[model samples]
Target: MRKILNTAHIYMIIGVVSGLYSRELTKAEDFTGDTQLDVVHTHVLALGMLFFLIVLVLEKQFTLTSSALFGWFFWIYNIGLAVTVGMMTLHGTLTVLGHSSGEAIAMVAGLGHILLTAGLILLFVTLGKRLQPAPAPGSDAAPDPDPAAPLPAPAP
Candidate 1:
C-alpha cells in the first residue's frame, strides 16, 4: 500500500511537470495547433497519477498487492505508460519543430496501448478474484478462496 501511494505521488509530480513542460515548449516554438503534448498531460495525470491513487485506496481496502497479478499489473502498466508517453513527447516535439515521423513511431505507440489494455484486464481479474467470498469454515463446497490472505483478527 505504501508503494502504491508512493507511485501515485511520483506520477502526480511527473504529470504536473509534463503539463508545464508542454506549455513552455509550445510557447517557445510558437506553435498554436494542437499536438500530442496537450494530451500527454491529461494521460499521465489520469492514467498514471489518478489511477494509482485509486489503486492505493483499493489496496488499503482489499490488500490487492497480496495477489501476484498486482505486481505484474504494476510493472506492465508502468512500462506501457512510459512507452506511450515517451512516444507522445517525442512525436509532439517533432511536430512543434515542423518535422514528420515515419509510421514506425505510431506503430510502437499502438503497441504501448495494447500493453495498457492487457494491464487493465489483469487488474480486473485480480480484483474479481480478491472479491470472492471466503468459503465457510468446515464447508468443503468451495474450500478456501484465497489461501494467501491472512485470517481475520478475532473480535474483542
Candidate 2:
C-alpha cells in the first residue's frame, strides 16, 4: 500500500512537470497549432497520476501486491507510459522545430501503446483473481466490510 501511494505521488509530480513542459515548450516555439505535447500533459495526468491514485485505493481494499501479476503490471505499465511519453515529447519537439516526424516514430509509439494494452490486460486478470469471495467472519482473514452497512456507534 505504501509503495502504491508512493507511485501515485511520483506520477502526480511527473504529470505536473509534463504539463508545465508542454506549456513552456509551445510558448518557446511560438507554434500555435495542435501538438502532441498538449496531449502528453493530459495523458500523464489521467493515465499516470490519476490511474495510480485509483490503484492505491484498490490496493488498500484488495491487497493487489499479493497477486503475482501485480508486479508485472506495475513495471510493464510504467515502462509503457514512459516510452509513450518520451516519444510524444520527442515528436512534439521536432514538430515545434518545424521538422516532420517519420514512420519510425509512429512505429515505436505503436509499440508503446501495445505494451500499455497488454499491461492493462494483466491488471484485469490480477484483479479478477483477487475478487474471491470474502473470508468467513472471525476466521483470521482480513475483514471485508459491507459498504452499505451502518457505521458502528461511537464509544462512550
Candidate 3:
C-alpha cells in the first residue's frame, strides 16, 4: 500500500509539473498560444493520481495484494501509464518544436492505450471478485482495516 501511495504522490507531482509546463508553453502570447501539452496534466492526474487513490480506498475494503494477480495488475498499469505519458510528452514536445513525429507516434500511443485497457481490466476483475456480499452492519466482523490484515497489503 505504501508503494501505491508513493506512486500516487509522484503522479500528483508530475501532474502539477505538467500543468506548469503547459502554462509556460502558452505564456509566450498571453495564453493565446495552443499547446499539445494541454491534456498532459489531466491525463496524469486522473489516470495516475486519482486512479491510485481509488485503488487505495478499495484496498481498505479488500485484501487486494493477497490475490496473485495484484502484482501483475500494478506493474502492468504503471507500465502502460508510463508508456502513454512518455509518448504524449514526446509527441507534444516535437510538435511544439515544429517537427512532424509521423505515424509511429500514433501507433505507439495506441499500443499504450491497449496496454492500459488490459491493465484496467485486470484490476477491475480483481476488484469485482472481492465485491462479494458485505458483512451485515454491526455484525461480529470487524469493519475494514481488518485489524488483522497485514501491513504490506497492496491496493485494489
Candidate 4:
C-alpha cells in the first residue's frame, strides 16, 4: 500500500507540473482564458492529494481500521485527480469541437470536480477517526503481564 501511494504521489506531482508548464506556454501564446485557471486548479488538487499521501505514509499505526481509512482516502484522492484531468480534457474538447449550444458539458465536468473535492475532504475526516492507537491485548488500558511471571507453587 505504501508503495502504491508513493507511486501515485509521484505521478500526480509530475502530471501537475507538466500541466502547469503547458498552461504557461499556452498563455504566452495567447490561448483561451479558461485554460490557465484549469491548470491552476489541477495543481492545487494535486497538492492536496500529495498531502494525504504524506499523512498515510508517516502514520505509525498499521491495522485493519487504518488500512480501511487509508484505502478510502486513497480512493478519494485518486478520484479527484481523475476528475481534475477529466475536466481539463472536457474543456479542451469542447473548445476544439466548437460547441456553443449550452456549455452544459463544461458545467457538468466542473460539477464532477467539485464532488470529487468534497469526497476528498470527507475521506480526511474519516481518516482522523481511524488514527487512534489499538488497545493492548488482554486489557483495554493495562499492559499485558510478562510471560515469565512465576508459576504457582505445587500443592504439598
Candidate 5:
C-alpha cells in the first residue's frame, strides 16, 4: 500500500508540475485569463493531493489506537475526491463530444488529471483498509509463558 501511495504521489506531482509549466509557457506566448485560471487550479489541486499523500504515508507508518477512525476518515475523503473527479470527467466528456456547449478542450484535459486523482484515491483507500495493522507479536491475551517450559513450547 505504501508503495502504491508513493507511486501515486510521484505521478501526481509530475503531472501537476508539467501542467503548470505548460500552461505558463502557453501564457507567455499569449497571455489569457483562462490560462491563468488553469495554472491556479492545477497548483491548488496539487497541494491538496500532496496533503492527502502525506497523511496516507503517515498512517502507513504509525499505529494509532484509533487507526480505524483515521482509516474511515481517509476513506470518506477518497470517496469525496472520487465524486468530484467523476463529475469533472463527465462534464469534460460531454464538452468534448459536443453534447455540451460552453467548455474548452484545455478544461477537458484538466478533467483527465482529476480522473487520475480519483483513481489513485480509490486505490489507496482499498489498500489501506486491507493493510491495517496486525496485533503486535506476543501481545495477544494468551497465558503467560511458563518459565519451566523450554523454548519453542507447543501451541495451545
Candidate 6:
C-alpha cells in the first residue's frame, strides 16, 4: 500500500512538472507548436498519476500484497511505464527542440510496450486467481479468498 501511494505521488509530481515544462516550451524560441508537450502532460497524468491512483484503490480492495506475483507485477508495471514514458519524453523533447527522431527511438518504445504488456498480463493473472472462490471453509483444496470478501462456508 505504501508503495502504491508512493508510486502515485511520484506520477503526480511528474505530471505537474511536465505541465510546467509544457508551459515553458511555449515561450522558447524553438517552439514549433507541436503537441509534444501536450503529449508529455497527458502521458504523465494518464499513466503516471491516474494509473497508479487506480491501482492504489484496487490494492485496497484486492490486497495485491498477498499474491506472490505482487512484487513482480509492481516492478514490471512500473518499470514498463517509466520506460515507455521515458522514451516518449525523449522523442517528444527532441521533436520540440526541432531535432529529428529516428528508428532507434521507436525501437526503444517497442521494448517499453513489451514490458508494459508483460506487467499487465501478470496483473490479470493475479487478479483472476484472487477473485476465485475460497476453499469451502477449510476443505484444504484451496487457500483463502480476500479477507474483505470472504467466501461463506460450504452449504450446511
lDDT of 1 by residue, 1-156 (tens): 889888888888999999999999999999999899999989999999999999987887788999999989898888889899999988998898899977989999998998898899989988987886767889878654465688899999
- Please identify which of the two predictions, 1 or 5, would achieve the higher lDDT against the true structure: 1
Clashes of each: 0, 0, 0, 0, 0, 0
RMSD after Cα superposition, model 3: 7.6
Query: Distance (Å) between predicted and true CA of 120, model 3?
Result: 0.5
- Model 5 steric clash total: 0
Mind sharing the TM-score for model 2?
A: 0.84
Q: Which stretches of candidate 4 lie over 4 Å from their true place?
A: 13-17, 20-34, 37-45, 57-67, 92-102, 133-156
**Could you tell me which residue pairs clash in candidate 4?**
none
- The predicted structure with the larger lDDT, 2 or 6, is 2
lDDT of 2 by residue, 75-152 (tens): 999889888988998898899889999999988888899889988998999888888787887789986677669999
TM-score, candidate number 6: 0.80
Candidate 4, 50-87: lDDT as tens digits: 55465555553333234555566556656765666656
Kindly report which residue stretches of model 6 are placed more than 4 angstroms away from their true locations once superposed: 134-156
**Each prediction's TM-score against the native?**
0.84, 0.84, 0.79, 0.52, 0.37, 0.80
- Model-by-model lDDT, in order? 0.89, 0.87, 0.84, 0.58, 0.51, 0.81
- Local lDDT at 61 for model 2: 75
Q: What is the lDDT, from 0 to 100, of the residue 92 in candidate 1?
A: 91
Greater lDDT among 3 and 4 belongs to: 3
Positional deviation of 19 in candidate 1, in angstroms?
Answer: 0.8
